[model samples]
Target: MSLVDSLKDIHLSILPQDPVKIDTFVFRLHYFWTVSFILVFSVLLSLSQYAGDPIDCIHDHNIPDDTFDRFCWVEGTWTRKLGFDAIGGQMDKAFLRKDLNFVRCFDESTNSDGKPHEDCWQHQYYQWVALVLVLQAGCFYFPRYLWQIWEQGKIQSLVSGLDRTSLIKGLQSKNELQKGEIKDKIQLMIQYWREAKGTNNLWAIKFYICELLCVLNVVAQFYFTNFFLNGQFAQVARQGLNLDENDSILPILAECRLTTYGSGGQPQLTSGLCVLPLNIVNQKFYSLYWYWLSALLVVSILALTLRILQITSHDMKKFVIVYFYRIKEFNDVILKRSNHGDWFLLIRLMDNMNDVVSSLFLDELEKIKPFEAYRADE
Candidate 1:
């Protein structure tokens, strides 16, 4: 069958009748649902910004109408002659400035032409940041997908059967015939457990692989995000803050100016600049990245530690039970009963058998043994 079909079947089969009893820690710790929510939020934020123009040119307000019109006409004609767009059309073509030098805003006293304009650099970078957030969310969820694909099916099957058997055994207590059937089922379960023990190492390896992926995903996010932000104006913000690369936090908003050198080697004001338009969105997103990613890292570490502890504890318990059974068999005294009473007790203890099933099996064994003893006495 196709993977999608198998996943659908697994999801349908694992739905618990009593939802309260279902353990959701695995789902939550896997981080798929949480990351998916973040992805959706980022997509919506991007769409909202897309509905309006993110960048617009800020024209110089100090210019007089007649002089400004003549100046614009001359500049526009020259720009068109040079194969550049008209001044009005230039407003729509605002791209991120690639240089490190800041622009100067127009000063009416120092400059003759009031030609300075500003474009929204923030708008351009914010879109990229939004895309990065989506990618980060996918990284958070990929490990969970790996687990579901590799291990979740086997885990769900085992847990489902255990739950079903426990429920049935609980309900069958008053009926002798049903109790006998449960006894047979318990024996089959014990045999399955014995066979499953041989593959315990294989299961442990699979579990560890998923655990490692979870850790690696968090580490990759930390470095990848730092690289992405630094590559896109984060370094410029750091320089503005007078902080080194290591000490600076990612800035959501910054202002810069674009200047051109005049013939006299004086800096002429060309444009006033505002970088990163969606400041609120970026601020919230980065704040969440700092807090949420840190918390997730801690939680993932703790979850992995707990899983390792659980596996160790389970292995120790199994070893102790098996050692005791071996010792009992070596002594041969447990074999004196000759009616499999001791064998049943050992199996029940070693396999972590249900108390009800153990009691029913012991009671039936007692009844049969006493009848055989009476017959021998006669």
Candidate 2:
């Protein structure tokens, strides 16, 4: 086998048959798309930043020289130390030269005079945001992992057995010997499930766990977006979209400060506001955050709705209705069949019903009266 096929075999051997694959909606939205988007976006963003220098000098003619730009590059990426002077509102270079003391942004520290403080890097913001997105992707997938851990093995085994049974009984040969073999196989499958009582109750528990995880994932996303993204992007997007009052407001992007200090400072740290240059990148990051949050909200709603329907389909009332419906359909087949066809139809119905209701309907089938050997027409 090729390397690709070998890897596929290894993966399948490890995971076997994952239960989450049975729920295509949840698997696609939560497990596949959500995780893929965040991680991919993070990688792209990191690559873009790494490929090109994140800081560049402004080409505005109003400034006297490139001193401010050079100072910013040396100071740090996020420090906003070079803006309008407090004494004179004008942002000219002369004012900055005289009154402005450009210190590296550093938080307050209790160190003695002349002690060195840590230098803050501007690219750290991008790094932090990327890390957060990667973490959120993992969080999004955690529930699916929980489901697989708790229920995947049993679900895969059951599904595999049903598939094997269907393959064996679906053969088109008309031989009496083959028909008898199919009947015996069908009877054995029914007896196996009948002996496996309370499996339906286990399914109910699994369904409930799936439902709870769906809701929890949604709630966690909202909380992480609001608090973890610094709420800046979400707030701005809401305002742009004219949303109602929301308590989770984001911090001002430009006004945000990082602590750094100059090499010769009195060991006293100072704060610098993020410059306008870095604010552009911050805006883009937050914009993407808003888009991701909105998409996640919609997908979570649809996935949760689908999960509820799947769970409800297994309830007692619905189960009884489906059971009777299958039986009535099976009886209709008996009216039009010879002895051989009747046996074939019965096994086919059992196989079809197994996929739908599994052991629940099979146990019910065991309680029902056996079909007559003679055809209805006879």
Q: Which stretches of candidate 2 lie over 4 Å from their true place?
A: 1-20, 50-52, 55-124, 161-189, 239-378
Off by over 4 Å in 1: 1-27, 61-124, 159-191, 231-277, 313-378
- lDDT at position 295, candidate 2: 75
Residue-wise lDDT of candidate 2 within 77-130, one digit each (tens)? 432233335577665353244222232333335433323334211333443555
TM-score, every prediction: 0.49, 0.50
The local distance difference test score of each candidate is: 0.44, 0.45
Candidate 1: tens digits of C-alpha lDDT, residues 82-168: 111356544222222322222232445654564433321122244466677767777766765665565545434333333444544
- Candidate 1 lDDT (Cα, 0 to 1): 0.44
